[model samples]
Target chain A: MATISIEHASKSFGATEVLKDISLDVKDGEFLVLLGASGCGKSTLLNIIAGLEPIAEGTIRLDGEVVNDVHPKNRDIAMVFQSYALYPNMTVERNIAFGLEMRRISKAERKATVREVASMLQIEHLLARKPAQLSGGQRQRVAMGRALVRRPKIFLFDEPLSNLDAKLRGEMRTEIKKLHQSLKATMVYVTHDQIEAMTLADRIAIMKDGVIQQIGTPQEIYSKPANMYVAGFVGAPPMNFVEVDLVKQEDQFGVILPAVLKGEPKNYFLPLPDSKQLETRENTKIILGLRPEMITHNAFTQSTNPEIECDVDLLEPTGADTLCLIRLAGHPAKARVSPLFACDPGESMTFSVDMGRVCLFDGETEELIRL
Target chain B: MANPKTLPGANGKRYLFGRLFIWTLLLAAAVLYLGPIYVVLSTSLKDLAEIRAGALLDLPHELNFTAWREAWSSACIGVRCEGLRPYFLNSVIMSVPSVAISTLIGALSGYALSLFRFRGANIIFALMLFGCFIPFQIVILPMAQTLGYLGIANSITGLIVVHTIYGISFTTLFFRNYYVSVPQELVRAATMDGAGFFRIFWHIMLPLSVPIIVVSVIWQFTQVWNEFLFGASFTSGGSQPVTVALNNLINSTTSVKQYNVDMAAALIAAAPTLVVYIIAGRFFVRGLTAGAVKG
Candidate 1:
């Protein structure tokens, strides 16, 4: 296993900059997931690591040796493409044996390796058939088997499970996880699915516009997001944001929430713990970032006072949990509640918002509040 | 591809009627296309008088080998009145090398253009496409002079070179478009597996491309086999292609036109391409549908 270090890598296709000043260090034996939207340079970054794409600037080092000048084949890396680009003319067995044959391995040994990987991926019965005769998931297994036969130092997977159906994708995801665990090989997987990123990665790198927004473990990114973008992108059903003014009413500091008090919504106040920063920053706006699960149907006994007194506007039942939309402080918010407390769409219900689990962000800068 | 139960009309009678109508129409078309060839073959086996009467649609009185005799030897091409055997050999020698060399160059150029992304690859590809689609008459004058300057004028080798040069662009265009239809990931995967350019092409790309190769061979053979303008312009008597000999045999003002001999010579001249079509006819259609039809 070798660590791959991308130092200030950048790529541009004519006038369009695809990747910019992107640097990442993938540890040895680490499953690093580059997570982003379709055009967010994740695949381009993976291609650079695989030596398939040339970067405009900076060097890539593998195992402390600069490998920017190395050719893809010489770099000793294996890759699985989303299309599962199996050789249509060759049988599945030959497809798996191709890399080994290219490396000039012995025929008997190649056969053994092919059988091992075929059984591992449960594609043994498909060995005699060409790719055209196989189904989508079977082709994907052959593609993975082709890569696995190489036993290269590093592995790159470019949306390996994207082509399969939902059930097959889940099955392949588990298989890939098991394969990585058994092999303990350095792998860099590129994907747009946050769920895949959360499950498969040792360290998830959430990217946007060619820059990395956050890089940490799944739990770390979920619990403490670096900014509004990271907080909004990682979670399903998303986090809720509401504009509120930090006000000091007497000896304590509180968030001045907008609510329907007099005619239209008024800036009603909610008391918070006394803080040096929040007490003096009156009239200054701060956004509250709270996940749907944080503001639940359970009682809010952890905070000194509840700031969000709101009515449920909509109910979205998702099997085990029901997602309820609430109008709190004149802004729409979402909360996750157990099916036990699930109410009808128009029911008048007030949820005790848990203030202790809320995140504060500077409204103008879109950055997290230090306090 | 259709199940009988799901067939149109859902009745055996209608299906049989449909099949009969299609067969009748196909038979009529076959008769229309092969009618002249039958007439030519008949006259080639007829005597001079029956041919002169132009009663070609009628059956010959009896089989005769006189036209084949005159067409092969002792017929006036100029003052000599010799046969077309030399001209037939000339055509074969010229067309075979031209087809082989041109197809090879085209397949290689097409492979490179389709797979590799060098700096000027696109520009070269566009120019080659432009070259293929232009009228040959527009460039023949300069091309002939260039061959003359190289001192292969009035020679069969000169004619072969000219045909090869003119055929390159079209051949390359065919193979390039065919290669484009091939999954590019195959090439990428081969590259990742440590196969070099030629290795990948020979081992992966070309093996999977027999259909296109058959198509290229058929198209280039037909094109070179029937080429008249280049053959006429490139060489004079004693060095002319079979088409040139046929022209000379029919163009004499005082000499009587021998229709029977002319048909035999023309059919003989077209025999190679016809035989090739018989061998690879299905593959040609398969290649077009496979390469051009969308997913």
Candidate 2:
């Protein structure tokens, strides 16, 4: 019900800036995730939005009314912490009713609210149980129940599911998505987990250092990362950056892999589509971005591709799939292959670079090129 | 380390031997510590003449309640011979309130420091921590003058306040360190759930910090109860704590040495804390062990 705005916001610790000239908006009923690694100030920004931390310079507005100086309790926003921070002493029912009690709501209404929230979260049977009595997932539910009872205008989650085991984390992630869909509450979630960002966010704000690298839908960030940082950070087994020189091959500009593959120690040429119009540029140093999945277990050519025959240096089995690390064009690169592929060290595997999906980045600037 | 379950009867043998050794050492330590207390109790039931013979470890050949009656009613330390019970009562009134108030305030303050980030909070915590390390005697003169200014000098309330003030540092430190271990999320959850400062402190923080509070109470009680200098300096005979009365009764400058009566008064002064420790011994040990392990 509330749209949160951070207008020209900045935060600092002493002289070191944590968030610099940052501005973001959480539209009414939007699920916006501030996604970044630790120390990237995503949590700081979330805390700023929650009125938990003061900014060095910024005005935050909720629903167009400035809330820069509002105390957190009066801001009508509830937060679910990563730690599940359920009051250890209080039973689940009391924990849920705490907000209502704080507002001096009538006991009858508070009880009803607690019951409603508990059942909604599937924690009703746990009403009389203390936090210690509950499992991690149950504690998580209590934390959510504690927040949901208030019917706050905005919901802030600071990596709420980061504490759960993998299976539980996935379940809760789905539950959160479902909860968001049903309630349509304006939520600002901060997380380092890209999976959470991808699954839960309406828009993902990917940040680096103190600056945002990109802000867009999950598809946009994954498909069209603005920089090398985003390209690498948003993917697991990450995006491979092969050092290359852009050269002109005949009539078209081509990217030159700087080194050889296997016993043939020479460059392989791959031409670029020239929206860049620089496909014919000679010896242009750049990096080619290829996601591990894009370079697959299948044959190198369903279409004529930028193919490289490389030595599979290492293979990691993650039960679901195998991650093959290969030395291609003299640089270490990783590829996600199907578990059916029996990959081993010291063997050559032909990796198909999906030229259509490949990203070109300026070598020195690390900025993605349109080509 | 051999697997415990696979060790056959080794566990039972070990347990029995360990108990025997531990009990033996415990008995030795008990005798060593309570040796003086035993002498005091036994000799306090003897006449002055028997005490003069100083057969220190002997059972009193002749038993007498004369000393107990005299110590409670007629052992003159000053112009009044109405023994140390008045001072004993004064000490109880002082120590009990002092410990309770100081521990409660310290718990709340420590909870605040641990849970919240406010301007100058760290600096305030550092100052409070430093407050605990300074010798209590150093603050006695200024504290007395301040109490006098507030018109409570030489009063029990004055002593209680002073003791509570002095006790704040360790109590705060104890509570703060313990509260720090409590997950910050719980406090945040409580706050987000609309519980304000005092509500969070009482309902959320304090209830979860029981072991630390027990630890704090036991520590503060022992400290405040036995505080001789504060008791002696702050009040004269009528308002003095039992330590002062015990000192006056045992070490009277102008009176003949009455060992039996003196011992009886010492025993009386020591009784409350001894009784308290015995009653709450399990909690005290639990609190202390938990505090040490965590800290």
Question: Number of clashes in every candidate structure?
Answer: 2, 5
TM-score for candidate 2, please give it.
0.89
- Span of ten consecutive residues with least summed lDDT in model 2 chain A: A273-282
lDDT of 2 at A36: 91
CA shift of B157, model 1, Å: 3.1
Of the true interface contacts, what fraction does each candidate have? 0.56, 0.69
- The sequence of per-residue lDDT tens digits that candidate 2 reaches over residues A1-371 is 59988888999987889998998887889999989989998888888888778777978999999988888899999998887777666788887888888899999999988888888888889999888788889988888887899899999998888878999999999999999999989998999999899998999999888898899999999989999999999988689988887777676777776443465676667766756546344576778898988777655357666666666777888888788887666777788877777467777776666778889888889988875
lDDT of each: 0.83, 0.83
The interface root-mean-square deviations, each candidate in sequence, come to 3.0, 3.9
Looking at model 1, give its docking quality level.
Answer: acceptable
lDDT of 2 by residue, B47-115 (tens): 978888878899998788888888877777777778887888898899899999989998988888877
Structure candidate 2, residue pairs in collision: A85-B185, A246-A284, A253-A279, A253-A280, A274-A277
